[model samples]
Target: MNDNSEIQDVELAVSRWLRIGVIISAAVIVIGLILLFIHGGSGYPDDYYPHSLSEIYSGTITLKPYAVITTGLILLILTPVLRVAISIWVFVREGDKLYVIITSIVLAILIISFILGKA
Candidate 1:
């Protein structure tokens, strides 16, 4: 295939994945909100919320509304990171060394920040 069509294919795949991530995140948040209403609270003390990934995961497993909402928020935050990762893969497949290097740097920074932010 020509470069133009190849580019379009990449864009389409990226767009589709982004859309899916957003829709899933929104749906999860909505479910959490609905649960909050039904439960009449966030299932946590007032002004308190999960502070770590583990906490969030445990709470979500327990069906805590606040934890569920936090998980949705995390998904939303990671969507762009996923896009960056996909770009790295695409660049590698296309044998674009320069872009692959740049995208790899970006992905590394994103991952580093994500991990450091947890500290």
Candidate 2:
């Protein structure tokens, strides 16, 4: 009904969305970790290309599980990084110090996870 109330509503909505994002990101990282473990922790296999560029040229590319898992892990890492970057952009545009702080923390956590995943 009032300006302050509208701002509170918007803030509440943003907070809820951020919480959901964090949960989803955590889930993705967990899933990626599981896949990495299940697939022997190797990033990718070179054998998926059928041993030559000519094979790919011939439209014969075998999809290796290792390669797929590695790609999935990379995607999982990149998704949260992109989300944090977007959040940072929005915070900057809106001049919201709290959101900037929160997003920065999230970004740091994602970076840590990526590093650990690599290890």
Cα lDDT, all candidates: 0.93, 0.58
10 residues in a row with least lDDT, candidate 2: 55-64
Off by over 4 Å in 2: 1-65
Task: Work out the TM-score per prediction.
Answer: 0.94, 0.42
Q: lDDT tens digits, residues 26-74, model 1? A: 9999999998999999998888888988989999998899999989999
- Candidate 1 runs further than 4 Å off: none
- Pairs with backbone N, CA or C atoms under 3 Å apart (clashes), candidate 2: none
What TM value does model 2 have? 0.42
Using TM-score as the measure, the top candidate is: 1
